[model samples]
Target: MPLTPIKSDDPVHLAMQGLFPDYNPACLEPAQDLELLRGMLRPRSSGGVKGLVHRSFQGVTRRCPRPLRELLLGLAHRLRCADPELLKEPNQCEFNRLVAGVRSQGSRQRGYAGKRAALCLSYDVDLLSCYRFLPTLLDQLDQRGLKATFHLLTDWEYRLDPALVEEVSARGHEVGLHGASHDVALGYRRDERIAGELRRALRGLGKNVHSYRAPALCMTERLMARVRDLGFRIDSSLPMSSMFHPSTQSCFPYPLEPSGVLWELPILLQDSTLFLDLGLSQEQAWSFVETHLKQVLELGGVGVINLHPSWAAKYSGFHGRLLDAAREWSDFAVMTHKEVYNCCRWGGAAPSAPAC
Candidate 1:
């Protein structure tokens, strides 16, 4: 008689079931098993008093006396390490499995043969300052022969310049909706209102808008359903970090399940969280990005990097160096979000569509 194969009942396996309900357990390899173990053993966020301590310590560690600061930083780091919200690597095994599923689907649909890994550069144009640096950012990308996606905030406090939005599209870059406003609570908005606002914003962006990213990475299932209803094909609002929201599960693109219409390309690295929140120096932040990129490539996953134009302008030299490094890094294909979505959704040859 043939031996029965074991179906895991472990929490990690259960979580994976929730994330990729269609995935085959037989696809679970030794490496992925190890990754799941690591994820399980890692620290998780406890959103009560422990979370408060983590936040408070993180806030004042820099200002403490040198020796005290060292102690505080160390303690905070340990606490954060335990925060289940954080991930050692953005592309966990389960998420990678889903990516594999998409790749397989694409191959079947269109016989798609593309790079094993992809690096997507994305910008959240929420601040007015972003517009000021847009020209230079575009120029840098052009010089390097790189493509990026710029997600624009349409109904923010400062009126959006349609000309600037058009310029982004006119160039070879992709444009995506960043939300009607930079509201932190945008995700919690009533469904009808959310749909109305998003629809209006999409209309303003014209026909090229196929992607969206919620303001501040604040997204809920209801919000995603609204996004799909509004006709956006892809969303990049999910982050690998649980610090933003507890439900963020993957760093790879997966159909927003149940609805199964919209694809979510999670942010693998976010500049604001690294620089503003974690207080990493420019060099340190870039170093983290390089490490994450290398890890993503090693795992054969997509690395979606979110860099804000406002922050880039503040550290132009650093941003320039990072772009230069990305250009030099040839191990993975660098693509715009739209191109990746096309391949993921329709299974065609990697698009060589004009960036504009």
Candidate 2:
């Protein structure tokens, strides 16, 4: 008299199967279905899913819609009743092959991509040590046949001898903005204040300021939007390290929401993070950089190294070791953040930049 429950293989079951085709109704009991339905009514967790589900959900979230999100939350609950051995055991050959296929494709981009690296030689102009070391650092870069983007603070430029700015530009280096003043709590400041700081920094550097890295490596979504509004093309504050990596997927070098004009190039490694955050010796730090750079280069991906002028001056032979290590790798084009963004392909943007 009553309609029969559909089998997982039945056509009717396809509508509720969600993302994966192998998901089967046979794997779930009637009690599991009731539990899943109940979970659907609960609010989504603020921190998102937990544990292995967190890893599983990353792939799922990128493409999931609001309705699909609810469906997935429910589906996950039902899926838990699946055979423990099936879930816990290493994937079968077909699944492993599928994973390998995706990984190989993702990695292939890094390998034929050309070798390019950007050395951002920056000064938080407010720092007195930076003033002393910047000139020396510029000379060193000249000898090494390298150039950098100098993100300067406007108000503090007077502290450095005036000729130094011209000398840096003369030697083929770039001067951009740090901020008008180095606010100790810059990131925690209000949005308008931050924008004002950027404007003041730009005004001090003269109008040629087009690229920016945040003071203290602190950037919020609002700050990024303000940067775009100000006509800057790139943001270099994104962290490439595991601990400080951007909290959201949007931080990766790609198109933005509003203008689609701004590009975010994450700093793969910074000198300070090695010296201060990790308390690693320069040699130890160089080892980490070498390993990461080799991996990225072998895969054909962008490798960015941010070196502070102060550190290079303080640590004897550190800068030389960094340059020597770079010489061992092949097919890398080292440029500034602005150069990379202008040349890098984002969405429809053409990759006109050369392999320098």
Candidate 3:
């Protein structure tokens, strides 16, 4: 579908236009209005008195003593968000709006080989608990004759089991990399620091690990450039979920530079955000996933299902059902990140939409 032009010289409109290049405001059964949809897709930024306070608060927080920053603040969030029941106080109404936002944002295009929509089940193996749940996850995928990408942790709190990595790869799954701990600083650090950390992580895992996603989706151009130079074929660092407040980046795949050699694979609806950060109930979380995913499928775009192994094990009843449902989706192909990359790169996919 051709993008409907917003024929206006207004700077505001131009910025929004940039955000939604192939803009097609979907008119669903109930007829969601254009303005309503625009509101949903709008990129919010802080301004005025409140913006000043926000900046001040952030500055003060950053200036805090190292001990307080490392232990009292950063470490607290790291542990808390990983806990199943401990929430970061998310807004339920915002979540509902996000679910609704999917309905009106319209179809996205790129890199899929056929008319059938694409699905990629990606797991972030961050915790020891997440590592423990791998066997069961592998069995489920095997039973369903499906494959997924499992990104192992490196330079995190502990190391991932090399044996487990071999097992996953042997079963026709992808072994990707999650660079460091959930600290968001990986992106903003100096170039040499980031490069050194990445080199250390890729030392021996480089050959097998072709996909990389940053911890907590923390990324910058320098960071990604380093990743691409390090030999990662795909980077799933930008998260797509309206609940991410002002940054509701859609999870539509596109080629990253060095002229499309490396792909940008964005994931929508991460389990860590739902189960650990927001602490939504299993039913609520799964419902949100199913609703938005079906819409994306109908739009003929790739829907990346991101599950943290720790959370999946915590709510196996729901996660298991999700796996079973994948087989029933006769309309789509569930693939690993590497598989998607291959299809788009070599399997005659249409030219992808501009990078998100």
Candidate 4:
């Protein structure tokens, strides 16, 4: 929605050239070459060996012993991200590239007017255990004068249940669906099942929720279409994670076409890569996060961060540090997901690129 001023070595411009060399951002995915973006966003359906291997990978990540899982996570961190400092650069640039392409490619005429970049801090309350951690996280955001978006399960039987959604909403945070349950396979269910669950989840999400992020970011192309059909205006379910979903390598907000209405706000970097996978300490983890945010701002792109409530104790003061860090590097607006949706979906009291 807003393109930061670009420079000669701007990572955002370089990212577009590197990620989508022959792309036409103004036309919205017209060339078949965009298959790369589509393929990265949606994994291939299992047929034979591919299916078996996929399931095995899923099993290990889901049911492996804690020790082995951590071992695997550490190994991945070392192998792919040998230098943790650069772990998120490639992915962040992919997003910056999108911001650059949209700006330079003559897609949308309006750009973010502020000299500072945009930063969005978001949380996923994926577990009932996380319910206990919300108050502290909320307090931290409140103290920092910042706001965030929270995604919650619609069908959980927590004592608070829907009230949790209301509390977050009342606290000036944006609430969105994280599916009906925390089931990892929820995004892969049959089309009918997905639609039904979406309907049910919407019912439970009595708040003015118009966004949907699949639990664990498990998603398919058809499933995404269904999500849009169910009337979600935004989907922050994709990421360029090395350890988790091999989602898109970019992080700019773009519309899913031929119907360019529902926006896909890609998450920046896999924080889970360092924290959940690498098991890095807070100091090391925050270093990586700080660097990533700086790069995002320098490129004039929005940063959507996904921190889990379960990590509240482990990463205390992150919200405060985020605002502080953002200010040191660039001017910023720490908005919820919905605020971003409105920015990208409308322009100058009229429809712009990727607008409704």
lDDT of 1 by residue, 262-343 (tens): 5667678777667755678888888878888877775566788899897888877668877887788777778787777776
Q: Write the per-residue lDDT of candidate 3 for residues 1-356, one digit (tens) a residue.
A: 45445435332233232223443433122453435433423323323443354334445545555455546444445553233332211122232233334435552334354545778889988766677778988998999998899887765545655677788899999888886544455666668987887777766353446788876565566777788776677888765553432332444555554255677666766776666566678888788778767766755556788888877888987788788878788777888888787776656543332221
Question: Which candidate, 3 or 4, has the higher TM-score?
Answer: 4
Model 2, 1-356: lDDT tens digits are 23235543322132222112233344333433433322221112222233234445535643555456547645644554323222111122221222233334332221113443333333444455677777777766677777677777666434544577777678877666677654424544568986787776665565565567776565655666677778777666655443433321111243333233665555566676667655678789777777766654433345557776667777657677876555434466656665565555342244432211
Task: Quantify all predictions' global Cα lDDT against the true fold.
Answer: 0.64, 0.51, 0.62, 0.61
| Candidate 1 lDDT | 0.64
TM-scores for candidates 1 onward, in order: 0.71, 0.62, 0.68, 0.73
Per-candidate clashes come to 11, 12, 0, 3
Which candidate's lDDT is highest?
Answer: 1
Identify the candidate with maximal TM-score: 4
Off by over 4 Å in 3: 1-115, 180-182, 204-206, 245-248, 348-356
lDDT of 1 at 266: 69
Candidate 4 lDDT over 216-329, as tens digits, reads 676666678787777778888877444445556655566654344677777875456656666877778778777776776666566788887766666666545655664454
RMSD of 3: 8.2
